[model samples]
Target: MSQPMIDPFGREVSYLRVSVTDRCDFRCVYCMAEDMTFLPKREVLTLEELDRLCSAFVDKGVRKLRLTGGEPLVRKNIMSLIRNLSRHLDSGKLEELTITTNGSQLARFADELAECGVRRLNVSMDTMDAAKFKTITRWGDLGKVMDGLRAATEAGLSIKINMVALKGVNEHEIVPMMRWCHDNGYDLTLIETMPLGEIDEDRTDQYLPLSLVRARIAEDFTLTDIPYKTGGPARYVEVKETGGRLGFITPMTHNFCESCNRVRVTCTGMLYMCLGQDDSADLRAALRASESNDLLYDAIDEAIGRKPKGHDFIIDRRTRQPAVSRHMSVTGG
Candidate 1:
């Protein structure tokens, strides 16, 4: 039997989110500031180092692996990394290997991804309107994203569209987006805007609660609670008469920290214990200083031991504030 990566809270940490690069093609207002500085190439972990680090975790019993980035596909030769990481799936060490992309570059790599053993994808698409999409993502071309979505669907990859609901921005498009997803045979997940990093928009004005979203959704369709677990924090529900399902990820209104079973490693190899907190361990330094895998394991174990019971997001009546200070783009959110 393998040793399980159990945190101090007694939750089995079986999922790993790896940020391959901090470089992104689009600048979303809610994720980071427009004038962003990315990490130098020399500072980020090499592919071999990432493979070794991930192998260490798999040896300790992590079964689910997710590759993320400012835009994962933008990382040069990402297909090579996908092929290398896919070995765990074939060996039965990993139950799933997935990636979360901005969908800006998926059309170019959809077929190669499927051939490389990547079967699941979470694509971020906040709005369907071309002008609104361009507004939300500073330089995004919605037509390109649509082409990518179509190609991925045709490639036989399970597709899920993640929409971040901003109060005055794209909240009105909730029902429309859901309808589109239902019509296209795709799953939709609505996420509340989190206060991470120095975003261009005011966090107070943009933060939309999932409760309000659920109410808005219920007005048009009856939602039946569905027993579905996507290995993440989203709560699933089936939209009546639609073959597709809807998910709500409420980080501000309701924190799912108690049942959290994942740990994130940034492009620079900083291990974040919680998404909404600043607690982290520098695995890059350990990997660079030592050749033994035991050193890397000890650092991960210590970080998990210090994981907080819950996030510090406070929501009093209608006011809300996030306790985290890191940028979502850099942390692989």
Candidate 2:
């Protein structure tokens, strides 16, 4: 058996988040800018390249794989890629393979995804309000997303809703969203908006703290801490009366970097050590030049050694400036 992939901080890096493409269908205001430019087809990694890279990581004992994207489903023949990666699970090289999507095309692909051994999904749905959903996504059909959700559930896929809380945008819908999830027996995760990129609106103005969200939920139901491990950074809690669980991902208010156990590879094959920092290694060069996996492994090991102790995301009180400036879409969020 191969050795475990451990970073310099002694954290076992077992999860790999791979961005298959940089092209997305919806233009969520917080995720992309109006005049966004996508990578050329020649620049993005091919399916074969992705398979090789993922295989290399699997060889190093990385067992959990998450396929992210500009909207991973948008990539042509994504089901084929899913089927290919499912072999890792079949071979016992991977513990789980999940996907994070916008749910735009999930309705059509849900059945096939389940057939290909994809059993878990994280769908981004910020609001249930039709008009607000369109406003947040720039041009999204709430009806289609809803249908997709139902389809995924019917296909026997475990679905989780990822709601990014924004101050004036969808903060008001938090309780309603939670209630809907509870009623439908679906898990919900509320994520704090991070200062990842330059959005059309001021990120500071829209930033909503998870603490406030938790407090609001407390008024209606008693939240009990739950013991759960999903290999991600969300803190899970149970609603006392409803029995439904809620996950709160507080990257800003609470820094979970000390327990960070994953690395991200962008569409262009750049390995990002931390989401809130600009520290990354160019894996594309190594992959293209090397005949063996030694160079790629060495490069990954080197990058992990240089991983910062933690991300510097706190706003400087004096300067009133955010630390990170990259866009979330590019970072595979």
Segments of candidate 1 deviating more than 4 angstroms: 315-322
Q: Could you give candidate 2's per-residue lDDT for residues 242-311 as a string of tens digits? A: 7899999998898888999988999889999888889899998889987788888888888878777678
Model 2, 176: alpha-carbon shift in Å? Answer: 0.8
* Cα RMSD to the true fold for all candidates: 1.8, 1.5
Clashing pairs in 2: 196-326
Q: Which residue pairs in model 1 clash with each other?
A: none
Give the Å shift of residue 322 in candidate 2: 5.1
lDDT against the true structure, each candidate: 0.88, 0.87
lDDT of 2 at 107: 94
Query: lDDT (0-100) at residue 232 of candidate 2?
Result: 89
Error of 2 at 197 (Å): 1.5
Q: How close is candidate 1 to the true structure, as a TM-score?
A: 0.96
